[model samples]
Target: MTPAELGIGIVGLGSIGTTHARALRQVDGVEVRAVSGGAPGTAAECGWPGAVRLTPEDVLSHPGVDVVAVCSPTASHAALGAAAVEAGRHVVVEKPLATTVAEARRLAELQHERGRLVTMVAQRRYEPDYAYLKELAVGGRLGELRLATTHVHWLRDDAYYAAAPWRASMTGGGGSLMNQGVHNVDLLRWLCGPVEEVTAQYATLGHGIEAEDTTVATLRFASGALGLVSTSTATPPGAPATVALHTSAGAVELGQGEVLRWNLPGVPPPPPDEAVASGAADPAAIGVAGHARMWREVVAAIRSGGGHDADAVDAVETVRLLCAIYEAARSGARVRPGELR
Candidate 1:
């Protein structure tokens, strides 16, 4: 390894972890030094023949590991992330941050205490199509956001869940919203603004899983914009997830990787990005370019001592919103994200 290379230690070797390893290969100046927690021989299967295999604890303490990527189950994210930051290693955790708002908040607090960088993987923020949309929406080119709606109607077969049982458990973050729709939820809030309140209803209409296979929610943005979110792993013959925005100026809708519709005046839309692929039918179909881009920016931030695109605090807020949706569904009340303890 070169002296300039940043060493990465992965805490899980499951699908997402393997994906991380593959994506990191596309990033310059970083190497997967070690990994822990997956079936035996998983490292070689992931094409990481040189990555040292060790226990999670050992991986954290390894002298060669400068960054720890926590790709474990949701229930383990809080503890693993805290341990990595406390060990003086920068961290990159997968989305939703944690299973609960309290856990996510505590991790964010610990990140502040340690002064170590902790970034959550919200890779859609790095996709060219979504990045362009964010510029237009956040830059006010869309003008005064009015309404935002996103739908994540994706299908997951019994075999898919059978392969990873955690994908079907609430504590494990196996729900449709947490597992599949989280990026879109994060994107919605990022593009529009904070969600002031949510009223939601969810059910396990299709799957036999403990968590809901389908969920629907109404959001009141702090910007006074109303929004709708519908996610389902039960929907068959799944189509690409979509985020449609209506503003004072006009309206635009984003497909998985391209702009589905554009009606805004005085502003030309970006050319379609054909490289983008949707995980609507198959999770593995989600390409690695976005993840590669995210890692590049994160590595740059770690080297420059600057901030990440999605920091721990920002990630906590997304979890806060997610918790509020569940809470609202249970209580039949208009729950605010901040009201979660």
Candidate 2:
């Protein structure tokens, strides 16, 4: 009700949407004023009982809504964000900002022209280990990055795919890399830089689904750093995902939320990090604390009349990379970035 408050309109009532609602509602001076997602009864049970349930358009056009959070599926993210941003509402997208580079770029330009706050949810950026790695990469503590390798192997049963129809297609979700491995995708790009080219192979593997369950790709960074990627949801008894960055000095390995290995001699790594719950095995298992922290940052950014970290323009690059990866795999050729337009 106060001028300091930000009324939020959240789209999608699935796990991530509920996660956002619960956390945003807890933040001071922020209200989950309205939501447009899931079925009415189901959405109500998730969170924000008092908030109005409206269609996405109505939610964005609503006067009380100061911001729109696109917690919807990957396919709906760009469309929802575009609508919200065009309506002059601040925006937040969950991940893969958009499926295509042009869509992401469009939102970025609109954000600039409209003078609105916009951010994408590459939540791993908020994770301590990844954040620390980012600091090292940016601060030159790890020296010039030569290569970054990642392995995101997880298991998802038939029922899991059945429950969420999106995971099985390119529309709602892309596949293992985009669905399960996207967080790591953002982290890799964030720690490394923009990717210039990618050569990849994608397959359905064992899952009875249309979307890919396994994929491998090699990346050429604009910074001249090359990287390797391996992702799948078919690995049995799935373990924590790992990313190893080989710099000129040494290598930095990141697991789930802990520093698996940090052997840079000149720059001493921090103390051992306690293992943190990674929503790797279970999407809903990731604690709401991270969302709470992100919301606080968003609220601050809004009040400051600026934008949050990983704004659409910044985060759109990640989506562009995702597109490149998929394209490379589909064509069985080395694909260059920005070629997905």
Candidate 3:
């Protein structure tokens, strides 16, 4: 390996971990140095036959591992990410940060104290359409935001839950909101600004899971914009998740991969980027373009001492928003994300 090449060790070689490994192929100067926690020979099975399979602990301590990608279950994200940082490795964690706001906050604090680069996997932020949308919204091209909404109406069969018991438990960060809906939540919050309060209701309408399969919430953004969020694994024949932005100037809407509507009069919409893919109907169908883009940019940032698009600290806030929604549902009262921790 070249001296400048960065070494990556991945924990949890499941679909997500394997996804990370494959995404790294599009990144330059990075190689899978070690991995642990999945079916035996996952590294080879994922096409990285050269990567050594090791214990989770061994992967963290591997001399070649300059960075650790914590693709494990959501419940393990905080602990593994913290341990990796403590081991003097930059870390990457999947979304929602942790099962609770407290854990997410603690992990963020530890990352700061350790002075390591930690990024959360909210890959949708890297999508060409989504990225351009953010640019336009933040640039004020969308005019003063009046309302922003997102819906992640997707389905998960019993087999999906059976394949991973943890996915059905709250402690494991299961449920549609956290597991499948977080990326949309992240996008919603990113576009609409901080949420001042939330009122929500949730129920387990499908798949006898321990966590709610459906949740609906109304948000009040600090910008005085009203927002709506609906997520469900109970919905049949899932379709692409969508987000719409309404402003004084006009309105715009985008599905997971395609633009649904672009009403801004003088502002032309972004050119269609055919590379986008969605896991609306089938989780396995999620494309790697977003992950690959994120990996490339993150590696470049690490090399140049620049900042990453998805900061661990910001991701913690996203978790706080989710926590607030759940709290509102349980208490039947408006909850503020800022007041979470």
Q: Which candidate's lDDT is highest?
A: 1
Q: How much lDDT does candidate 3 score?
A: 0.88
Q: How many backbone clashes does candidate 2 have?
A: 0
TM-score of each: 0.97, 0.93, 0.97
- Name every residue pair that clashes in candidate 1: none
lDDT of 2 by residue, 1-341 (tens): 35667788888777788888877756888877788867776545756677898888899998999999998778988888989999999998888788888888999998999999889876667667677777777787888889999988888888888987888997777599988888788878888888889999989987889999999999999889999988898888777888899988988887866677888897766554443566556766776766776788888888978767688878877888888899899998889886666
Stretches off by above 4 angstroms in model 1 are 1-3, 39-41
| lDDT for each residue of candidate 3 in 14-126, tens digit (9 for 90 to 100) | 88888888888778889898999777777877667889889889999999998899988888999998899999999889876787889888878887898888888888888
Give lDDT tens digits, candidate 1, residues 254-334.
897788899999889878777678999899888888888999999999998998769998998889888888889889999
- lDDT winner between 1 and 2, please give it: 1
Residue 6 shift from truth in candidate 3, angstroms = 0.5
Q: How well does model 1 score by local distance difference test?
A: 0.89
What candidate 3 gets wrong by more than 4 Å, as runs, is 1-3
Worst 10 residues of 1 by lDDT: 39-48
lDDT of each: 0.89, 0.82, 0.88
TM-score of 2: 0.93
